[model samples]
Target: MCGIFAYLNYNVQKERRYILEVLFNGLRRLEYRGYDSSGICIDSDLSQPSIALDPAENGLADGSCKPLVFRQEGKILSLVRSVYDEADSTNLNLEASFSVHAGIAHTRWATHGVPSPRNSHPQSSGVGNEFLVVHNGIITNYEVLKETLIRHGFNFESDTDTEVIPKLAKFVFDEAKTEKGEQTVTFSQVVLEVMRHLEGAYALIFKSPHYPNELIACKRGSPLLLGVKELSEDANGGTSFHDSKFPTMDGQPKELFFSSDANALIEHTKKVLVIEDDEVVHLKDGSVSILKFDYNKAKNHGGLPRPASVQRALSVLEMEVEQIKKGNYEHFMQKEIHEQPESLTTTMRGRLICGDSSKAKSVLLGGLKDHLKTIRRSRRIVFIGCGTSYNAALAARPFLEELSGVPVTMELASDLLDRQGPIYREDTAVFVSQSGETADTLLALQYALENGALCVGITNTVGSAIARNTHCGVHINAGCEIGVASTKAYTSQIAVMAMMALAIGDDTISSQARREAVIDGLFGLPNKVREVLKLDDEMKDLAKLLMDEQSLLMFGRGYNYATALEGALKVKEVALMHSEGILAGEMKHGPLALVDETLPIIVIATHDACFSKQQSVIQQLHARKGRLIVMCSKGEGPLVCSNGSCRVIEVPQVEDCLQPVVNIVPLQLLSYHLTVLRGYNVDQPRNLAKSVTTQ
Candidate 1:
């Protein structure tokens, strides 16, 4: 829900202006993740000590320097302006150079307090600002720790859970220095001590004057990665680090970058090491060291053993920076919505083999091939995810159950955790997420692991937590979705799951023709999506007709039910309109009461097995003088909507199971236009974060 970016350079002189620019640009790349405030912390020139300090709190007798911190309650640009304004007002030198220095920046999505400068990150220990920390994710036990620190005479300036972290570090450092002497305690040791008391997800970067020329970062239940740029002669022009045991040229790294997402570091370096849970990364001099926190020892408090050293391999990132940019499109959502044709093709690139005169049709998923037998024999299959991922599963559920001959069920990750739902050893659980680092889904994965379920992950990210921890899984290959509202990933997910179902059902003879038909549909699916996207102008015009409305309603049944729900979600979240998706069968029960001429309603009566039922629904809604916008097949608009008064949206028809992938395209475009027409942020809506890292 928040973004973190830090930069460290050693043995290379860089001006303060260049350093601040790098930090600010990194945060700008992560602006898509959604945040209310932004801040940054950089080292001050210690020789001059430009910042004034309170005499009573100055630990250094000569009034030592404190880190330069700039925080603002709005966009990253505002924070940048604030920094320049301070520099201009004080006549501070922006040309000061440093050979070895570290800086950290953050974009915060509020959880513990209101959005204000006082509540922004780069939170410090006290008036002396002994320790500065930029943190992402929730600190579940912060209240208890805050109270204890307050009793110890530690005053807090910010009302953030992050404030407790720096104070706790100061407390631990003081206690350790008094007992073992100042030279005996290390920065990593103090950080490990502070981590022992923390209980929830967090990715933290700490910098202090006491530990100059060094930086320490640790993460648990949150995402973090280190990017390496080596300048040593042994580094074969920056390509040799990929094959090295560590992210170094000759036992040292020339530069280091830490970020919560690879997007922030892609422009700096492609070689990165994803930090695993409980691993503490320390950067000193010109080298890096990874230390593993021993949770078992911490629980017993048996004098807390020194953290064990670990090795992490550096992997090259596959994505290019151009993929994240909105080249010709006005907004990322619009670009992604139009990119569906190619994205769907990429999702099925090597997987679907269409039958020719020489061979028969087949579906190959190498990640699941070894475990297909166990999945086929499982007692049940459960699809677990949240939001768009969950809706994609719903879109694929009926077909999977029909082909696999297994009972398929759906569960929202949070609700499943609340109920402690039954997960059997014989069950196959599939976890789906675009980012793959979803907090509740990860917790549910741990729960399923404890219950012995055969867990599988389906995500777009390659090195995310779910991909690393699952027994086996699939990568959707829907490249670099930058918008807060997901578009291409939704279709790609359904396409992948459809292939999965075909693979599991390959042994049955009765469904051979059915499977071949689906295979043909798969081959033709991308083209169908291409055709559906032609309705963009139409959807935009429709949006203009309904943009002023206060609420919207959508109804569907069978396969397209997921389409209705997803469409409604897009409108509600990005368009800032109240909308609801209803089952056509349940319309008579309660939803019919809300139907009238003034309210706009969308009914998906597309060509499918449920076409007749949906046609009947259109008639029923028409009898009530409802303002109907019917989404139907190209030639079936007259059949679905016999009357001339109702608005009609004609979409290309595909296979029933594959229609949701095409059906959701127009709605995505409609939502994008409606959001722009309403003057709201289309890519990053208010009060929403792209990745739900907090409960």
Candidate 2:
């Protein structure tokens, strides 16, 4: 995943320093998206003879005045340092070095090219760098397109598939001009020609000297949002762009902000228009226009995509700006772990209700209400996801199968695609992801859709790809999870899925007691989660004890198996340790060999059908002098621990199927503490991302 940010000030030129500062601030806020390299393009005023454009340090110099691109092969901070260093050596003001009207910046998660300055973004096209482009998502046909462009005498500098966009745009622009027998063609027409030839998903933003006042953004299958601010309106209703917060050389009241995430622009404006697929937006002349891109028909007509007669209304973001920040906690992961109590409450709000006994407890999930009956009647239900989301699906699988009497199967999205699995119209396929844009999950959803299975999406992100493409879905309103290792979203996903299972089987008389029990457990979950969070200090103490251990093992049976897997994952993901989750039943088969006094083995023997079996497993481990850490029901701690022979972590008892929601909390805390003890970056773990947008 990558983050794209752009700014356009209408009617006034901004100081280069102010522009860079704002752009850099936006990129820093979006660092949660994860990136390996970053770059920025500033439209410089070349008419000023005092401005010296260094060709080597910047990009290849164009004969005409054009945007200057500065890129680095590492973090966004490194790029900022490079820019500031260059400014110091040249004796130029950061604000005056490259004054411009518009600029674009990008934090890249490399997919098409190696993580290097040469392969970084702000890719340009044509001899004078006519178009400066930044893009997200993949161009599946880039290889063939690149070959064709090379045959047409185009040279390339980087190995990125994105480099082909500018070259192809230049080719199309020249071809259209030649056919029209004109000295110049409109930039919008050239964009249409380029869109017609491009294939696969992309969210692209570009600037061209031909249309210096405007910035063009187009997207299909990738997220992009346009934020608009009214510069003329302030507290006193003045018409000046220079606000007290942001000082500007030329006062202009109008600014347009664009980003892949809404969080980046929340400080500037809450009103945003989410760009839909195959839509091109032109932000210029203090206005925005939306155009629908259709290739073949548009080519035969006037080489223009159909312009939308009416613009889509702006949607105000419900989340507050402060929610994105990690406050009171050292890391976003810790904050999220502590936020599960409220997140689960929000996820169940208005859905799980406790009324009179005559009313009977029930769930009302709006997105899945009408589809529950169909799902209950389906031949089978397939739960699909990747990583933490996958563990969440596994956590919900048992509850779904037990309540609805529907066989449920769990599949890793990638593996499902690799096997070319069978899906039928009678099946109900459910896709779960924290960021609805998980690449493999989205691909799996497409495959299931093609097989005619009814698709359902359960994701934390609203308006994500899976949510839009699925027939029906639930948004697990866990708020924004900035941590790379998911904490709140997993519990929230399980909560939503548990509610789904409750809704599907509530009407059956035989299952009424079971369903009521689960509904009651769900009602108590938020408080139970709050109670579990109290173990934070204890978990930290335990983590300190285990920090020196080289390997760790977690054992569980029944519903808590998912908990064990997820807990182990959290530790391994953020703590950077070798951890494995093994079924207690499978321990005799092989895993028992690893158990010893030197290793830490966490066991989940919480009250369930398999509680007795797990207790036996713990006894066996203890006999072998294995370092035992037992998680069990509140009062049963003594029964499982036996005369304080082993360490114990206690959790309040809940319904059998719903135990996973509470059981996972302490493990999450342990992982967080372990990472902190080891002095690792808890929020952004190495080589992991909040969202996996690339397959």
Candidate 3:
């Protein structure tokens, strides 16, 4: 997971300074994708052309310990520890934008390459090595190319999938220079020519000496955006995008910022165009042109998705998707757990913006005010979902019922369709799905609609089937989720339900209160998520304790009951072990028989309405000689049971419904850590893909 950005074309010096600021802030916004080192390159001031143009040229610095080549062994993080710049995340003097017209910057969460300066992107060639490039995603086959290049007299620098781009780019250009007149074709063309030889996924931005006027970018199964803006000279010496680029007008700047996602473009210019797969972007002079790779062997590859668009600046709604996979953390699970706090914050932001400890007696239902009123008059409400979405619905039932003074019932779509008759006539139904296209959930929504229920879908994907089917529903705004066993999406769905509960409570809060509470929470979420990351060591420790255990019994009550189920599902999905989440009350009837010193029981006892009741279950597990691990709110500790045999994890405090937003994070980490500790493949768990499109 990495963030990439580039700035090209600047008539004014002040514009360059502003560009760097906007670009850096944007990368920082997307730091959730894990990376150890970061750096940017532009036309170097010290850059000089090679004196020897022929392959026979010699007398160049090439080796480990030299200024040019990067040598790294061991794990990616360990190598990063040796050379990474602590102050700038390996990208030093980030304010340093070269005098050159085009530049490329990178935040490296290295995958195919070791994390070192040599492996870092914006790699260049020639005497001064002024030309630079930056990249994200995997270039799956590097060893073969590196081997081929080694035989053909390419002096290898770093062992990275990324180094191939710069090396091959220059190689193609250098070889072309001998047969074809250099003036006949530009460097951007050479880059595309080099791209023809590439296989696997990547989204890159670069500048070559041949075409100094343009910033060249390309995408394949990863994300990139070309952001356009107009520049205005600052009154106080700071630069600003010209008036035309701002909200008052549009289409002003040929000046632009490019990135894999919007966060990097948001701080620069809200106006952006998302680059699609295999599409090449030539950005310069305030405009963008999309191109294709005619020379590539697989020019007609069909796996590539439809191209993305240049959209406007997105808020926390999309930030959830942005944060979960590629943040500065080592893995998507890590970033997702760390995102719990913000996930919780975003969930509570819009509806409870003003309420304090007193909680405004009821929810402030606005857009749903009329429908919620009608729903309140109904006898009961049915919540439908499948998989993780179902777990979230299970967690949300009591909160929605209690806060709105309406009855709430939850069920799994697969089960609801096959096992029993669904509720009918005038009842309200909320269908939850991260990808609204979920087949089982969609069928359930159809069933509810046919039964005459007022169907509402709570989903992340905007235009999916469920969203289209629902009369009026809420968007979780979780953005694109790239994991099979849902992490951030689950929490996003929970947060959306919590906000909807608050909104459905009543519609009386002033807009001022809504903005104050929600907007502030949105901004404050990064810090809250930071708090969750601090618990990483603790969760890892817990995972170590339970590593050898064959079975795990997770229990929670109120909003966390579903949280318990989701946590258990994560362990089974990633850890490949037997785990089950049951209601605390259900244990006395069945699971209590399984409790023993050999069985590990995980309890979700966060400080909420059901803490006391759940604690009693923990007490029984301890009395039965069961290994007890509890996740609870920070402080109010003294977690020792009457039997004095228990372990506990404390997370940052949040609202009851919002508790799942933070509470489930530690559980996700617990699974990921356990899997990693056991040497399992965390990214591609057996029989899983990032998306489940097939039946």
RMSD of each: 2.6, 4.4, 11.1
Ranking by lDDT: 1, 2, 3
Give lDDT tens digits, candidate 3, residues 336-387. Answer: 5555555555555555444467654334434465577777666778888777
Which has the greatest TM-score?
1
Better of 1 and 2 by TM-score: 1
Q: Per TM-score, what order, best first?
A: 1, 2, 3
What candidate 1 gets wrong by more than 4 Å, as runs, is: 48-57, 60-65, 233-245, 249-253, 355-358
Residue 672 shift from truth in candidate 1, angstroms: 0.2
Clashing pairs in 1: none
Residue 79 miss distance in model 3 (angstroms): 13
* Clashing pairs for predicted structure model 2, backbone only: 17-95, 231-253, 241-252, 241-253
- TM-scores for every candidate against the unseen true structure: 0.96, 0.92, 0.54
Highest lDDT model number? 1
Question: What is candidate 3's CA lDDT for residue 237?
Answer: 66
Q: What shift in Å separates residue 407 of candidate 1 from its native position after superposition?
A: 0.4
Candidate 2 vs candidate 3: which has greater lDDT? 2
